[model samples]
Target: MARSKGQTALNRAQIVETGLRLLNEVGLDGLTLRRVAKELNVQAPALYWHVGNKQELLDEMATAMLREMSGGQGSDPPGSNWQELLAQAGRGLRRALLRYRDGAKVFAGTRLTDTGHAEEQEAHLRRLVAAGFSPDAAARASFIVFVFTEGFVIEQQAVHPMPGERAPGYDVTERAEALGPEFPLAAQAGADLFGDYDARFEEGLSAVIAGIGATLGPRTQS
Candidate 1:
């Protein structure tokens, strides 16, 4: 239930964080404004002044999480060049989201669509443009990366037990059992698909960046 710096005692970020704590304990289905308020030792109405209703609280929590992913202003410190900076920024964002329990789910839900996360997108867009992309292309590519990463995170956390839910989780091999042997790849790689999300994420991201890099290769004089 940590609060943001420079925010009030009953700030939006604090309320959002309280919500996240509730999510961890009671889960999204069981989460409610009252539950969060009770945890924070405040009246629900007091939380409303800052965080609004449950849906808004969820979105704001997502925003707070994304900003936290952005880290301290200089945390992603620019490396030797824009390439390094872009990759470092990307890696920082990726690592931040991966650190929390259900980190991807929290981030994937309302984080990017919210206004606060737009700043992070804009910063990446600026870096991409400097790295030789047009504004539109940079923006598009960055969005793709965000979407892909979020989806990956959520899928990875799906096995997590929520309140009142029974799960140490199911077997991935259950699905593998259904596939026919003609699917040569599934016979070998099904486990890999359901497993090694971190490696899969990096592989996908590397492919994305490589494509972008190739597109912008070797600028020439007109």
Candidate 2:
């Protein structure tokens, strides 16, 4: 039953929660102020009082989701090494994004400044700095991890085939036959590269972590 007028009030959290639900149901494109308001049994204008506009709402929703994910793994256990910690974070982030359809799309380039999760990000940067990276390098490394994960997941989700569609990536077999003797290596490489996406992601992620570690110099552990 709908609440009476006096009890029918909306707040920012409520609006954000409702928006997240809409995103999960219809994804980013289908989410709208009207749909959110309707879900809450309130007028569209009522939502405006809480969120400035759709972009603002999306930003808050993204922030909330990220905060929740980061909160669950706030710190590494005592005595854990930095590489292990960073790897765990990378995998955690990927798993969080995979929980919702288009999650990477929702998160790509959404800054977390002053959004309640800034401290968490800062702590990560500080951890890198303590491991001997220059302040500037630490910042760049932090950004790179997010960028790599976002880009990787965006491509992964985009290419995932829907029902009745062929699997993702190329059909190199037919192409190899068409090319005949002209491009044997290219066709074989295509087939090899596209086969195991999970392994591909792990290999890339390990490479990225190693590259970042190299930038920290010999002081990475001390």
Candidate 3:
């Protein structure tokens, strides 16, 4: 149903939600302002009030998606260890992103943004800094976690998607299989790719957490 002016007061949050829905249905390239407006039942011009343009809208959606993934973990306890807390936040964000189709792509470069994801990163940054990390180290460490999580998600999504009837196009798997025994590693992992993401994500995450922990200096005596 088309909304009246009284109901047309959609904010950026609503706009980003609409964008995410469109992305899931039509995907990135097929997504457009017209599509979003049609889904929202508003004129395209109305979106400009929230998103400015398509690139801005993409950036907004990316930020919004990452922010949505950042929650469900309760607040850090007072005086809790910082390394564990940081890993918790990173895993929370990655798990949230995994719930949606093509979620990683939707979240690219969001940490560098001032939008929703940046707000989440700021929270992580605060905890790290308070734990005696320098601002630069805090920033660098947060970024390492972000890159690993997002990169892992991207690979997982590409090499794996939900079981469904594939649409007509180049059969990617056919080409991959045709590469033959020369690509022994790829062939061996081919079947393994169908395994549980939760297991792999956790496995990868544990290593990341361990790596970060190894680099930490002993606590300073106040």
Candidate 4:
């Protein structure tokens, strides 16, 4: 089959968008350049022209997801303090990851293909610096916050797998029963550990932010 003259030329953005949709439908393991190409009615080699390989396509998808999360502008809300800013970023990132199947796994360890996020990242570091953190400390603290959110979401997706869905073997009640009466504390802790993700994330994010502040010391007047 030949592409018609009216057909729009393929681009990186189109490929990434298609890949994300496929990710939701088939998950990270099922998503492939060939599938994306088929979705776009193009040959697999055509996708390679825009994305060198599957990993490159995944990187592009992650970048696109983050871009969408930031609404194409990564700035903290007005008057947001460093702690507030850190918490907001964590929450936002988690929401973004939850938007796709295996999102955290796909996003983790992938390099951004472009510098679009650099300015926003710089702004975050600058804000922290103004809050009295040394440049290195600011970077480290920011990374810690990010890593915590990523790790949390990875575990979250593993248990939930998808929205309104739960993987087998993770049921709190079943887990408690499986542990039997001997492991009372462990059985009782199931609800606290596995239930109420929103609350857990907020609590964990708050604790992380507090720890960062405590470890980094008092913030100077900006």
Instruction: Choose the strongest candidate by lDDT.
Output: 4
TM for candidate 3 is: 0.74
Model 4: lDDT of residue 116? 76
lDDT of each: 0.64, 0.73, 0.71, 0.87
True-vs-predicted CA distance for residue 26, candidate 3, Å: 1.7
Model 2 agreement with the true structure over 1-222: per-residue lDDT tens digits: 344667656788999888887776787788889999899888788787778788888788778878778878767676665566566777778877766667888888665524576777777777767766788887777667778888887776665422123443456677678767788787678665555667888888889889988775336355
Ranking of models by TM-score: 4, 2, 3, 1
How many clashes show up per model? 0, 0, 0, 0
- Cα distance off (Å), candidate 4, residue 112: 0.4
lDDT of 4 by residue, 1-222 (tens): 456678898888899888888888898889988899899988888777779999998889888888888784356778888889788889889989999999999999999888878778888889888878899999989899899999999999888878899878888999999999999999999999887889999999999999998887346634
Clashing pairs in 4: none
Selected candidate, larger lDDT, 1 vs 2:
2
As for TM-score, the candidate ahead, 2 or 4, is 4
What is candidate 1's lDDT per residue for 1-222, written digit by digit as tens? 445466457877677777777777665668888888878776778886776677677677776766776655453354444455545555666666655556666665563435765666677667667766788766666666667666766666665343233244345566556666667677567577666666787787777667656665224325
Task: At residue 154, give the lDDT of candidate 3.
Answer: 74
Stretches off by above 4 angstroms in model 2 are 1-7, 113-115, 161-196, 216-222
